[model samples]
Target: MSETVRIDSWLWATRFFKTRSLAKAAIEGGKVQIDGSKAKPSKNVQPGQTIAITKGTEHFEVIVEGLSSKRGPASVAQTLYQETEQSRSRREQSSEQRKLARAAAAAPDHKPSKKERRDIQRFKRDNLE
Candidate 1:
């Protein structure tokens, strides 16, 4: 017989989410789905199932490969599933984009001039109208 585990417990055990409660919350919030259908925290999960989880700006697509009832080390947790190639590529691309955006937004060594500050204030004030 194939092994099955609760969705929340599996998520927590695999380290896809930090805590079981958080995993439950995400499931309740509709941030986690199984086979393209929304699932409850108590839903049974088995190997060969596809799970999609959304957290903040990232979405993960994973295929369950194993089942575990206990949370374990990172290496052990990593064996629970395989991340989809598209998901991995998207995550890397998004990370690179965020890094570029952050670098662009960070002011080098120079402080804003008085005129620049006034312009910013004026722009904000104009937008508030």
Candidate 2:
């Protein structure tokens, strides 16, 4: 309904962040950018404007398609922004790479067994002066 909405509020409304405070924090921490430059939480967002959001290892580049101040359902929120094809592909690639990395860096399940622990201790003792 509004012609322009606050970036932080829009982010939460669009479900980009779980809370408005987190959106504000992200804006302040340089995780959200407008037109390739950092913007404040209170910055007004307009339709057709591009925004870059970074969450964890995924970076999203989206064009604001609508503006709203109230949080809405996921389906409705998704209409607020249009993610570019490149951004989508990049995100998918990043996700795949993360999966592969996780698989490669997999750790043993649970803690070491008592026998394994004793073996580790013995190995350490043998190596130490």
- Expressed as tens digits, the lDDT of each residue in 1-129 for candidate 2 is 658999999999999999999999999999999998889988999998999999988899999999889998999999999999999999999899989999999898899999999999999999995
The 0-to-1 C-alpha lDDT of every candidate, in the order given, reads 0.95, 0.94
What TM-score does model 2 achieve against the real structure? 0.87
- Candidate maximizing lDDT: 1
Residue 60 shift from truth in candidate 2, angstroms: 0.4
Instruction: Please give the RMSD of candidate 1 to the true structure.
Output: 2.2
Clashes (candidate 1): 0
lDDT of 1: 0.95
